[model samples]
Target: MTQMTRALMTAIGATLDLGCDAIPSPGPGEVLIRVAVCGVCHSDVHIVDGDWGAPPMMPLIPGHEVVGEVIGLGAGVTAPAIGTTVGVAWNGGACGHCRACLEGEETICAQSEGTGYSRPGGYADHIVARAAFVVVLPRDIDAARFAPVLCAGVTTYRGLKRAALKPGAHVAIIGCGGLGQMAVQYCRAMGFRPIAVDLDPGKLELATRLGAVATVQADETDVPQKLRDIAGEAGLRAAVVVAPAPSAFTQAIAAISPGGAVIFIALPAKTRDYLPISISDMANHEKRLIGSNVGTRVDLLEAVELALTAGILADIETLPLQNANEALDRLRQGRVPGRLVLTMA
Candidate 1:
């Protein structure tokens, strides 16, 4: 393999510039991967626009949904052998000795490194990743299809898992965008009835094909009522708000049944981050509000397995690696109806 690699790099408030870098050998407990494909997430656009603030490093290669083949291994790494296909998500690595890590909750570990943020990521032909954090992937499926599973798939899966809803429970997936589409499939695969809510009728129609039992055209003021009507007497068991709009949160918080939970999975811009809630209502209804970061290594594995076994897949459109900037532009402008993946091959 060549010792140099091509990548799309950008600093905060700058555009992505195609550049080259010497592919560094993996350090201990790390692996060098030849990237097969990388999913362009909305977060990547946010990073480039400085919406999430300056990244820990400048000229960042922003991508968390990465799928690739292991080409080299550092010392003390043996399980994911050379040539094995693997996937890397946003939670790059965590300090094993932290209290959260000991409880198998590495996603919340204080010392966790975020892929594409705290560390160099997969927006390149080659990437170096912590071996312990890469999830081994099946070779049979098209690798490009699995890229978004590393982020959009696992993020929604983990968020819904945290709700602890029973089988046949009714869960409302607010926003029928990329992440919301994936969440709809997962809800069905996990044995729950999903109610898809979106302002776009086209997205709602696609969500219906993906397994949402019900679809609601989101009217800002009527969303909660529509969900309540669809959920019937049992009520909306839980609501996973994947839209980064405050109005979405307000609707979700009001739609869920008493004692149900609201799982927040989207990160909005700093300017619109605050949400005013009724404290008394929450206390009286016993509604739970929880924040879910990306999932741990274990959760990623389960999410992949469920996706493969249950025929859950992201609705995606592929673009060449060099068109990354175009992909980000589409996402930023809401022109993409589903996830966009950039293929290196």
Candidate 2:
């Protein structure tokens, strides 16, 4: 291995530049990984555009859905063998002494380090990660295809779990983009009939191929009524809103049946849009509105296992590391059908 590595970095907001750099060695309790592939996520766009606070550090390498092989292990790290394939996700490491960590809710650790945001992420040939936060990928799964599962897959999986859908439940997934596509597949695997909602017919068709029982065009007249009709007597047992649009959240609430739950999984730039539900309305209907972030380590491991067993793979367009900016633009404009993955190999 070379003593130095070249990495594509965002030196300033909205600009990606390449430079040669010395590879960082693993610190105590850390593991050095040779990055194979990294998926471009919406959060990466937020970082590049300075949407989520300021850039954590200058010359940031923005990528969280990372899949790689362990090349070196730091002192006191013992579990992951060198050369074993593993995945590094957004939650880099958490303070295990925090109450959240002690309760097994480490995803909300008060002092958690976010991958790519708080630390150097996987947009380079080699990246260092804490061994405790890395997930070992299954041998049968391809590394590239498994990358997005670290973020998008786990986010949707945890959102659905929080919704608490039972078998044969009616579920609606808004926005047939990257996250929505995965939600459709997961809903099917979990024994729910998935209704995919989107403004684009092309994405709806893709969702159907991914096992959606029905698709509703968001721009259609009376779209909420249409969804309610399709859901029939059972109505929507739960609706997972993967789209960041505020209107989608309002419509999702309207589409649910009595005693149903609405889970918002995406974070929008604008936070002012409100879903107005009277206190009496919520109490009488037993409706719930909640937000879910990414999943925990156990959730991520289960998602990876499900991906390996069910052949659940993200529909991705592979791009070179240099085209990361272009990919981000496409994603921001909603021009990309699914997740875009950057290859550093």
TM-score of each: 0.97, 0.95
Q: For this target, which candidate reaches the highest lDDT against the unseen true structure?
A: 1
Give the Cα lDDT of each candidate: 0.89, 0.84
Error of 2 at 320 (Å): 1.1
Q: Residue 334 CA error for candidate 2 (Å)?
A: 1.4
* Candidate 1 residue lDDT tens string, 1-345: 565445545566667877778887999999999998999999888888888778887767889999989999999999699999999899999999989999999988989998988888888889899999999988776777778888999999999898999999999999989999999999999999999999899999999999999999887568889899999999999999999999889889999999999999988888899999999889999999988887998889989999999988788999988888889889888999999998885
State which candidate has the highest TM-score: 1
Residue pairs in steric clash, candidate 1?
A: none
* Candidate 1 displacement at residue 109 in angstroms: 1.3
